[model samples]
Target: MKEKLSRKLAQNVEALKDIFQDSSDLVYRDIQFTESRRGLIVYVEGIINVDLVDQNIISPLIEGLVKAEKPVERLSELPFTRISLTQTSTASDWPGVIEAILTAHVVIFMDDSDEVLTFDVKGGSRRSVQEPSTETVIRGPREGFTESLRINTALLRFKLKTEKLKMKPLIVGKITKTDVVVSYIDGLAKQDLVDSVLDRLKQIDMDGILESGYVEEWIEDNPYSPFPQMQYSERPDTIAAQLLEGKVAIFVDGTPFVLVAPVTLWQLLQSSEDYYERYFVTNFIRWIRLFFLLVALMLPGLYIAVTTYHQDMLPSSLILSIATAREAIPFPAIIEALIMEVSFEALQEAGIRLPKTIGQAVSILGALVIGQAAVQAGIVSAPIVIVVSMTGIASFTLPRFNLATTVRMLRFLIMILAALFGLFGIVVGTVWILVHLTQLKSFGVPYLLGVSPYRLRDFKDIFVRVPMWKMSQRPNSSSETNRNRIGAPKLRGRADEHEGW
Candidate 1:
């Protein structure tokens, strides 16, 4: 019934009703263009800009047709220039017409004509752009991506106002038909990489894409791996930076978070603030983050192994202190650590799921109370409580939550290994994780691009924040042919003085 539009206005309205059954938001307004000529306007109520339709579409047509001496069957015969609409198109089929309506376009059907004119008046209540909660920076633009797809693209365009910036739109999902835009700089990003991303996205067969994570799972290089292959950001500056660095960004409709692909593990540890701050400060912070990252992953297991089997490796004084603390505890070192770790993890989960007003208070108070009470009850040792608390704190230093979660999960695995074989098990598990890291690929790009592949140029921005002038070339990991980001430093200051001398 919705395959084609009928010439009769009543029949077309009935077909629309059949398709949109029980949806009260679908509005139908019958209009008398002239005493003789008639038509109908159909649009979703809330999403449509009612003022634009009334002022531009309805007023122009009604007044123009009334003043005209002759009656016309087609609306194209009347002058449309009098209206203020900038975008107007004719859709002949029901699919195109219905899609346009769903995307906030007004559809006008004439009494005798088979075609419907769609006006793009996409205005509705939407969240205003606010500073991103995840990627906050002290020295950069505070604006972030909104839920509106067009607004997100416009934000990107405002950052990178180059003709080389390209946005290719694609529709996915059968039932919802969500809008997705693939954005990248034209010549900077590798053609093969772009094609691979497009191919993977086109193959997505899903009922609906509720968020960017949905698309990430389907199109990522490794779906089974616990590590996140694609990085997601709600900040426009972050997305713009990735695009300029020869990466592709997928912008999904109705989601503020956008996905950037071919991300490396080093990139996961980085924050937007790293680039915004001075090189020395950022370098110090980077090293600190790396230190905590290791602690977050191995602290608990190392503590367990040391206390249980590697006691001789510790100093006599420290061993005695730990022994004194665990004198009353009956559980083994592994069990003690597991109890505190599990309790801490539970508190963290509750904090996130609970309301914001009490979540932080609950997590902090719960950890303090549980740790103090457990120590008094002799159910767990004090040293184990300290280790678990340190591990949780270390995990918070990771900039990306997904990477933090990966660390959290792997911590338990390593803990199990430590429980069985002590220090030897910890070494074996760390090596296995390193091997997995080396093997992990994000869209065919090495996950450890600068570190494993040993590219010196890429390392300038990876492990340490080199001075902006020193980083003359973009990351070789991006596979850019024209990698020169800044030309050779000109003879401007000291060099100019030397030349004058």
Candidate 2:
């Protein structure tokens, strides 16, 4: 069994050095007050705030010890208390000492004491808060969550300052020792939901978790499902909004993306700016998005089905124009559509992976040049190019990246089905998708909750986001009790309610 710290300072130092073998950045500064009095300050070199250690810890401790009339044994006996009392602690075991050092705490060992004092001087290079690159808004908070866990939590607190707001912190990854915080409002979040989330997270026994994605994969309900069960947001306002609706947010350290759970199909379609904008304008934009959603998922398949098997359904002029364009093309409609779709997807991927300075230019120029060249060469018809371009544009309208990705993958399958069975194949594929969506669950909440289950209480914000006053009750899936956002929302609000819209 491992031993506790020894009274002899030399012995403790040697044991610590043995535990942290081959560590070049492990710093140990020895302080000698007199011939018999000695101390050692141990910490990792780069992670800690070096200046804070020198000014707050090392300088104060040394000065206090030198000026002391007699030898001081306990922490209270020391005159200097610049460091907050709550941030300081004493540990006597080997495990405690090692954990403290690894987590950026400053540990001081005296000549004849078995107990060691640790100070929380955790600091390192970290990115400052900036606007989220992934989710942008025209009229919302510009600040986004930083990689720092404390900063992210602080941002949430800044938005929600309530006693009921609770953040339960837990550590995962035995090797990485990653910090994960489950944030929610106590009375708002369902008891069973919080327990279920905690249970799934506690069962994750991974050795290391490098990012939020690792935890997401482990805790998600279905491993094979392509649709993401949780929604990821880099904006504090988005997370705060989700929390108020009685959802739980998982915040993994070292990542700006916070994961919110029990998401629905409608939630994925909703955007942050929807609530900020006027209800009428937001309703129009949502309808447009819903239309484009169908276009992205079914347009290519519909095109293939129409020309191949249902040519009679089209007008003579349109069919004649389409036929004229494809007359020189050697490949069939399916092959032509597949080639363009695959090429367009490849260009999109390359654009994302390439540097920002040239990525947009490349995607635009490459698409124009390739489409023109392919048309001229008769490898692909002009109509197919236009269809693929329209489909790609529609896919970009999706607010969530994961949902968009799911649509892109499903598009290929639908296209294949359409090629084989024409309109019948498209219908079959659509039914299969609808059935799957109805069966899917996100943390026991139906994926198509308000639509498939048809909760009339939750219908106000599904197809159309009703006015803020009309959306008084929270969705039953998230919050069944304490559902009122404003008192008697239909009864009209005072000036403070901000329900003028």
Candidate 3:
């Protein structure tokens, strides 16, 4: 069987050779021993660590006793070799060789044996774990996950430090063979949720999955929706908290962002820093964030409605001021607002795409020049410009860029609706949004848990974050069991101590 397998492998090698013909980095070597035995070693150059292979396998086997007439006998007798050597009874084959080489493992074959010896030599260039620039916190650990799968998994292990923490590996993407790990706490997490996540992942049959975002889009319940169904974070502490609460985390190789399932709309408004701060301060900040969120999504639409259809909504003094500002403008209220919004978005995109040294200055200069030029030329009203500016500022208060973009896109839709039917259209749009959100599910959990369904047990950490001591249980929506996170403290008075004395 070993001999037959080796012959088959040899035939497949010609096919693999043709497949990798244009590749300058692929290394192939055909070895012939003194006894007329045949074999081959194939690997990609830079991806595989050459030094370790040379020291561990190649140097000893080729330069030492294995280089002689009875190389197979010599290798079998060698006691100092660290590798678990095997003998193949079949012929060394091509597909097996290609698979092993691509994985950064060294494959060795010998004449008259069917088994191929595979040595693990995975060391190569990889980025070191560093602080996450996008999700920085002053009080927590600065270290963030690297692109390497092993390193990312190690970071999680360091935080969890328990056997209950489970990481199930999956191979996604038919061509890319990208590795994805689904992590969760076993006992704390619901079994059905885990099974659902796994089932969804298995259903994905894409050609490639380069990042967690791809998986998120593929497995999401509502792909057409503007809102993000999965929450992404580079912070391990954030992931740890979610995992403890029974939310499954998906870590894709080669990307820093990790995807957490069953996230609520309110969760997108939260920051990891909220838990680190005092309860009262955190609650105030949460409310402030919620206010900004509404302003970001609705300010432009509200302005359009009031200026075009609901002029009576404004006070007499404010109405006069608005009228004076618009008198010199050449365009209608809708066009004026749209122009400013589009210009602001263009400036933002330019700032991001430009070089860091000049981007900030360019954005600032662009905003100043455009605003001043528009005011002087009477192309747009001064009050409209102010509203757009305030709206831009409010959008920045959102922590997640994906969610910010969602708000920006939806703001325009609301604006159109408001223009058509006034405040009634705005209310109708709001109802549509809420209906979609209420129907959406992240994994198997409702997206509007604590607010829509009104679960009192989960309220402590949602809209208004309570102190750490007061939050004695994990989020109820996240886990069906193991909700307790802290134990109750027994009070001891001074009188009780005196009586004991």
Model 2 lDDT per residue over 334-361, tens place: 9999999999999999999999999999
Q: How many clashes in each structure?
A: 0, 0, 19
Q: Model 1: residues >4 Å from true position, as ranges?
A: 491-501
TM-score of each: 0.96, 0.96, 0.90
Per-residue lDDT over 319-370 for candidate 1, one digit per residue giving the tens place of the 0 to 100 score: 9999999999999988899999999999999999999999999999999999
Candidate order, lDDT descending: 1, 2, 3
Candidate 2 segments exceeding 4 Å error: 74-76, 490-501
Q: Residue 415 in candidate 2 has what lDDT?
A: 95
lDDT of every model, 2 decimals: 0.90, 0.89, 0.79
Write model 3 residue lDDT over 413-461, tens digit each, in one string. 8888988888999999999999998988877678888877888777777
The TM-score that candidate 1 achieves is: 0.96
Give the lowest summed-lDDT range of ten residues in model 3.
Answer: 83-92
